[model samples]
Target: MMGLSYFWIDGGTYLGFIVCITLLMFILIMRSFDLKLRRKFTRVAMAMIIALAAGALELGLLAKGDTSTLIYAALLLKYILEGYMEIAVIRIVGRDYKKIQSKLLWIPFIVISILICTAPVNPSVFYFDSTLGLFVRGSLGYSIFIEAGFYLLVGLCICVKKWFTGYQRDALIILFMLAVVSTGVLLEEAYIFDNCTLTSSSIGVLFVYVYMYAERYNVDSVSMCYKRRCFYSDAAKYAKQEMAIISMDLNDLKYINDNYGHQAGDVALLTFAEVCRSVKTNKFILYRTGGDEFMILGIKSSQKEAENLISIIKEKLKETPYTCSFGLHMYKPGEDFEEAVVKADKAMYDDKHIYKSNKNKQANKRDDRFDEKVQSFSNDIDFFDEGE
Candidate 1:
């Protein structure tokens, strides 16, 4: 007997629609995000908006007490859109899903869709009671909840995987959002509130958007690498474990800028970053700590492996016209991370000094050869004049 006003007054659906529409517009209009990320957010925002809109349609039809087929159609569309929302959430949060595992996720969705479609004929998933003017849950009515819960659980597993792989902060944020959605679902299932699930999902999406937007500050826009602020934060997380730190400084960044242009200097920095990314494994992270300074933090890497990585980087740089000075230090389990970084810094300076000394020696040798050639020519001219 609830009217359309009651549906709007509930506030959950209305608020959710506003949030979703805003997000969709932001995703479509924003130029800062990559295509892949824009696509992900777009899918999620569209799915949520559609799902909430379908819910509203179903509610409106139910309020009218119409025995027409439109109510059933509306209900079916709502259920299917809800399922898509679950799938879209999963896709947005995780990137490790394999092709086979991804295909398997669709199986449950297909089964739920089939069950929903059959409800009109077999009354398996849900049945409309014209006598009571109400829709009643059937034997398989709980399938949608189960399916949604399953997707949430899968998302949790992905978060845990990220946690163990050294992305603790990011994983924690995602887990918190999933927990919010989970609470909403539990509340709705308990009949304590209506539209709690969709509202919660919208709120979760908002949190993620805010968190991601804030994360932009942690990235260095020039080189597209993590900034100095994140380096200290991420390094502190490895205080209790053995870690490897590599300090790198470009050899002649100022020279490049003064001789060429600042734009050329930026190209050199980006080239270095691209090479580092190519040689870095999943266990390593790159951070640009200063204008010409960068650092590599490695998890569970040995000294030999670190040295080999340096060699690989040097070899890669040979393909270009630039070079970098490097220093490697292994941080023991009980040692201070800052002290290890200091040692790495000292080593990098010593290496830089050696590079400069070698360059000067080669320049002196070239100068001596030029002087000898000039002296020999002068002697030849003098001897020819005396003979004449």
Candidate 2:
């Protein structure tokens, strides 16, 4: 028969193993779905695995009737793993990929993992040995103290990262506080000073889970700028503001796409949108309502101010290789916003026609010049031939 410690087959051990397996499976399934989501959930799953393993080890020690040394080791391992996992999740989700790999931030954690796995005298295992009572006591005290020091160091690292990154937000602040509390409790446990207080890391874990769920599923699905739902909401609330709607469309966009390819068309649209962002003053909210069309909503000042703004935009376009046509309409207070938009769109179409006419006139003038040049060349050729 296998050497069975009293805690090895205990109910708690079985329960912990079951929980650990379930969490591991959950993480694997999440990874199968989407890469981004997998990256977000990996830390949570890893943390749960560590916690469950520690709990199972504790139960095993109890079953073996040698709980003292193993319990402290298991608990210390659990707390340290929990802190690392929590901070790792925050960093992964909050940072872009370049930031994650730049400073070799994962190195310390890898070293810690190797140490935990290969340490000859696992304080937890030492505590549970019946023949070494004094040895167990000393090891437990030393191990707990070391773990507490490590936790404090980890907390300091997190604080420094947050300071340089300027990530002093709600979730991070709560995490920093929890780390401090956990460090203090571990220190108390190490010194045998007093009854260790309950650290809030467990509760903070719950809060983080809730936050992740809400962030993943609860928000509107519109594109980043001027969401469709928000537009309706704001329209309802600010109906009394003297609104002006400007509608714009890129000129000869289809021609450009056909000649240069869709990639060039995309570049054109992005360039035009950037120009719009630059010209649209702080007072205006810009929306790309459809392909090749955009809308800007703002409080109407005077017609002269609006005209001046449009004139400045036109001057800027003269320097660019492509042009766009715009139509503007000022809304009277209590007027229908939809009606104003339609009027602006009509004005834009009219402007497009005007632009096309001017372009055609320029092209005709060029053609006439080419024809005159060809006639002059023919006359020169005839005169040279006659002289020869």
Candidate 1 TM-score versus the reference = 0.64
What residue runs in model 1 are displaced by over 4 Å at the alpha carbon?
1-9, 96-101, 219-225, 232-342, 346-388
lDDT of 2: 0.54
**Clash pairs (backbone) in predicted model 1:** none
* Top candidate, metric TM-score: 1
lDDT tens readout by residue for model 1, 1-388 = 5345423225788888888888887776666865666677777788787777767766666655664676777678778877877776666666433431356777888888777877777676787777776778888888887788778788888787656544566688889988998898889778676677887888898778767767678877666578988888977787777788999998878866886677667767877887787777767888999989999988888888889889999999876667899999998888878889999999999999998888788987844653353233211111011110
* Per-residue accuracy of model 2 over 282-307 as CA lDDT, tens digit each: 56665666667766666655566666
Clashes of each: 0, 8
Cα-based lDDT for every prediction:
0.75, 0.54
